[model samples]
Target chain A: MEFQGFRRKDGSVGTRNTIGILSTVVCANEVADDISRHVEGATAFMHQQGCCQTPVDIARVNETLIGLGKNPNLAAVLLVSLGCESTAVGEVAKAISEAGKRVETIVIQEVGGAAKSIAEGTLLVQDMVQEASRLERTSCPVRDLVLGLKCGSSDTTSGLAPNPALGIASDLLIEAGGTSILGEVTEFIGAEHLLALHARDEDVGKQILDLVKRMENRAKSAGQDIRGGQPTGGNIKGGLTTIEEKSLGAIAKAGTAPIQAVYEYGIAPQVKGLVVMDSPGREPEILTGLAAAGCTVIAFTTGRGAPQGFPFVPVIKITGNKVTWDKLRDHMDMDVSSVMEGEETLPDAGKRIFREILQVASGMLTKAEISGYTKAMDIYTVGPVI
Target chain B: MKNDAIMIHEKDNVATALRDIKPNEKVVVGTGDKSSVIQVQQPIPYGHKFAVRDIPGGEDILKYGEVMGRATQDIAGGTHAHIHNIESLRGRGDLER
Candidate 1:
């Protein structure tokens, strides 16, 4: 299978060819945002990181920024940095340039102030946007696609309908020699055992189990139950009784593909097929993590309607709740509620979703993208901000 | 007409109501060869679960043919089964010693 995409020099295929105005620290966000806001073909990645207490988190911020810059969706990148921040701005720009993308840097402190920084950044972004506009879509095989799977605002129908349907779509993509990433380690509590059964080897299976154990311990260390926050109020009101139930349902999005490998937060996968990335289930963190992992497109299944998208990668919103489909039509991209009605089989629904994915990959804008509802983004860090 | 409820797996003792079902309503759960009719004992809201068979207290509640949690109290067949009567067995820090 093939879709029209922007073929990057690094051999990655981009569904959207846009310039990225990335902020290296929280202090440079306004400047980066202003730069992207003034450019038509530019998007900004603003996050609250780069300066913090721990060396671990600062390193993570630098690595994540490099990954984000390497993403094929960005034809070129302009990094906004605060000169005093701990983020390795030079290394990040060098790494992205090494990935075969044009990269420029603007230091807020060195530029004399925010106003001057934005002015300089805007001109840089405008040039990048012009460079990006010259790239035309070309036919790219499905194998070049890296798909990210996520489910949120779940209800009971999630397990039975959209999730399983998405699972089928994931399976189809994998069968086509594409890659799909499954994150949300916290949602694997009771179902980790079942998921481990799909691992490529004993070591991979053990890794999956360890991720779940570590995620559970993080909550337990805080002297609280994970269930207190998981299976959120909307999930409960939508008929999910326990986190176990939600986990069982959520794993359905992974489909039946073999788990090839596991990766840390924001790390790109080395192997194809279905892989696991360590990330929480929150929209902001997970979406950013997926984007950093080099995913050009994301499939988000929501039973109660989640509207967030990434600035560059197009997030396709799908749902299985008919009521949510009717009420939140503006947010949803596809509906597989017919699976619940028994009018459409799982495989048929899966095929339909697969087609939608191909269309979106070929440059069709998702509702979230069209509505510009994609600003809630953040980098996941283990340490507290200083 | 659409089935009133759905049983994901044959081993599942609970069925999810496809629509709002009222007390004493004879809800047809599942579809085709895998379906059965049960007299609902209480109002089951849309998307909520109801015990398709009687479940004893502290017994495992099955869904998608896996243990989702344990019932807090004996739940009669055809009645609602939810957080009020079911508790997750995993990730419970309060249970840690």
Candidate 2:
């Protein structure tokens, strides 16, 4: 139940060690991306939220940024600031610095322009990267591992095979006293009761129910029924008849473990075992939420297919359908198609996935990591663009 | 030989067709006494479901041993079971925002 991990000075364990080039606002994304791109051992945290929001919403933005900066995976942080955004860049840097990592800042307005800021940011990133590169991996127990679970572009086979297989793997991880995060509040629409049943207590169950209700109502507030979008055409073509069916399959990623706690979008899990996060099902949003939640790795289950990866975390794409696996072999990391083929059992596949997670945690780059598919990521925002 | 359609649970009335099943193609459900076979009444695409027996409209359509939805129309044995016939019984328009 132990895997190689990087020990952060914050007394937390990290599965990956890298310097993060974090932006204070969307306007500063280019500068952050430039710095991270030009420097090795660095990843950019590009997001599109900073200004024009209510106080409540802006607070959410700040909280998530701080959470991301505090992620143990980041050995050091070089924050790029546009200097006028609502997100507290200084506070974010201070928090990460207090967590015992190298922290530096480059403010565009203060530095005169984006060009000068990027130049400063690049040097800062280079120094942080060099420092991060020297960190070594040590044996860490399963309890230190945090696994983020996500399902996207799902077909019927997702619920039947890979999803269930991942559920088993999730259960294995949780049983080993590790943490597994089940996100995608929208996907829980028709399956909330089932999910609530896994909650540790009645209050936690109510929280699970309320989160599902809130997410559904949020969609409804936009003036449309969620059913119009639930079973994506691909899901129907793949044999899912209703939103209920799709959700039933989607929830399988959490396995049957007790829901230990509930977390909001971007708030990292504070406890061990299976935790649920309030997040959308989209790749960009959920992936960012997972990374902010401090998940060391992502277990992405897909039946149809998904190829996106987060800039810092390693995304391990798993598929249940043989056809999608064959079609997207280069994108997919593990194939649980044999479960449907009756060639392999679910528990066996689950064990194999757990082993793969250990390997990925031990620095064996995932397909998403190897192909450099990380970059198209963003933090989730509930409020409008205005 | 492996079953063409996978029966996920004993209570499931429909089995997922392993491949794109053409009309008149024989679809095997499982092995042993619980197993059954049906003829594909229509073209069932890969990853789609087909009824193992006739299902009356308004009855619960079971999958993974749970109520996935309710059939909106009578579906004959081996007919494709999908949105055209099934109405999601939970949380679509049922919840009050």
Writing each residue's lDDT as its tens digit, candidate 1 over A276-321 gives 9999999989999999999999999999998898999999999999
Q: Ignoring the other chain, what TM-score does chain B have in each prediction?
A: 0.94, 0.88
Candidate 2 chain A, run of 10 with poorest lDDT: A219-228
DockQ per candidate, 2 decimals? 0.75, 0.51
Candidate 2 residue lDDT tens string, B1-97: 6688876788887888888889999878873336677888999888888888899998899887888899889989889888888887654544544
Two-chain DockQ for model 1: 0.75
Which number leads on DockQ?
Answer: 1
Clashing pairs in 2: none
Maximum-lDDT candidate: 1
lDDT of each: 0.92, 0.85
